[model samples]
Target: MAELLDDLRAETASFEALLRPLGDDDWERPTPAEGWAIRDQVSHLAWFDDAAGRAVTDPDGHRAALAGSGRGDGPGDVAAGGPAGSWVDALVLEARGRTPADLLAWFRTARARSIEVFTTLGARDRVPWYGPDMSGASFVTARLMETWAHGQDVADALGVTRPPTARLRHVASIGFRARPYSFAVRGLPAPAEPVRAELTMPDGAMWTAGPGDAESVVRGPVLDFCLAVTQRIHLSDTALEMAGSPAREWMEIAQAFAGPPGRGRAPVSG
Candidate 1:
């Protein structure tokens, strides 16, 4: 738990560093996430961070606050009419008048509070989240995943290339574990056969998941796999080698983060 928290803090710090140098104009730059500016992306993170803290400290209050906003039926509830993305859009719109500094400050405060709560909680304790309850470990990993995924949008909007690091192992793990949910959410049956993930890390070490003898395999750079699973880049645009029917199909519709099905990026032509 301590190690995971350390990694979470590192991921948060890296994201903050990315946002720290941007000028006011840069905050309004449109990101690849349809209709969301850089500010909107950061604001979304800030809102969720605070919610995460509340979930740890006061789950009932969190649900009440979410219901009060008419954002959804309750905390983490996306059953309301319209696309799940609409809930996020509404939240971002509510913060339209906030300055970039205000957004940053909110994020920092919320992040600190979340970290404190997680550090104090028992590892086995479950905390309510937007979609489902999560253990202390899963909760931290979820936050890390969000921070990295959103940071990718901010980096793309600025035309900045942030090299992938070993921290991506956590992101890839989430993507791999989300395989069944990815299919279930789309009303498709998850394949009975398990898919193996074999990725080469940035430091040249290999990360492998699943049984070695599994018939399905996804092999490539960990970075590309992370981007594909996060829906930041089309699977076809990546160099990942898919070895079985299940692996290929999973890559085609992979999504690590929760919410409704995402409109993944278009393929890049060679």
Candidate 2:
């Protein structure tokens, strides 16, 4: 567990490293994610990291903190109060005029605070978070997943390629675990049968989940699966493969990550 938190901190650090080198123009660049600019994406990560730090250091604060502290809510709920498409619209409007350096500093401070709180926690501590109760370890994993997922958007904004990291397997696993909620959010039955997901990790090792010989299969690079769940890498992109009835069903509304089901984004290609 300590190792996982350490890795998460490292991932956050690497993500910040990527953020720091961006040109000023890069911060205002529009991403494929509809209304979010590169700066908004960074702010989103910073907001969640700060909130998670608060969740750990002051668990009994307000309901808003408790409600948005989980892995799923990081990017999803920033505009939860408004109508469809209003959240991102509002956020982008608010983020205007913020320089890339401003966003970078926000992220750096938030991430440092998060690492501090995370490192101090006992593994067994139950942090009040969105969706469900999470151990400190689970919370950290969610943060790592969020870092990688949002990092993809920043990479895309810069038209750069980030080498897929082994940590993405951890991110993909969270998305897989959220499958049931995805179905529920879409008003569908959670599948009774398990779907097999076999991903080739960045290191060329296979990470398999769910039942083999199961009625459904989702195969591809783990990075794609992570992106699919996070709604960063489009399904149409050269990232993942899907097969079987359950796999197809899952893809129709495969928002394995949290926040108000992102129904406002442009159609994810493929």
- On TM-score, the leading prediction is 1
**Model 2 residue 264 distance off true place after TM-score fit, in angstroms:** 7.9
Candidate 2, residues 242-270, lDDT tens digits: the string is 78778867865677556567652354454
86-153 per-residue lDDT for model 1 (tens digits): 76778888998999999999999989888988897776888876666677777788789888988988
How high is the lDDT of residue 97 in model 1? Answer: 99
Q: Where does candidate 2 clash, by residue pair?
A: 72-258, 236-269, 236-270
Residue 6 error for model 2, in Å?
2.1
lDDT of every model, 2 decimals:
0.82, 0.72
Q: Which stretches of candidate 2 lie over 4 Å from their true place?
A: 64-98, 122-124, 264-270
Consecutive 10-residue window with the lowest summed lDDT within model 2 = 74-83
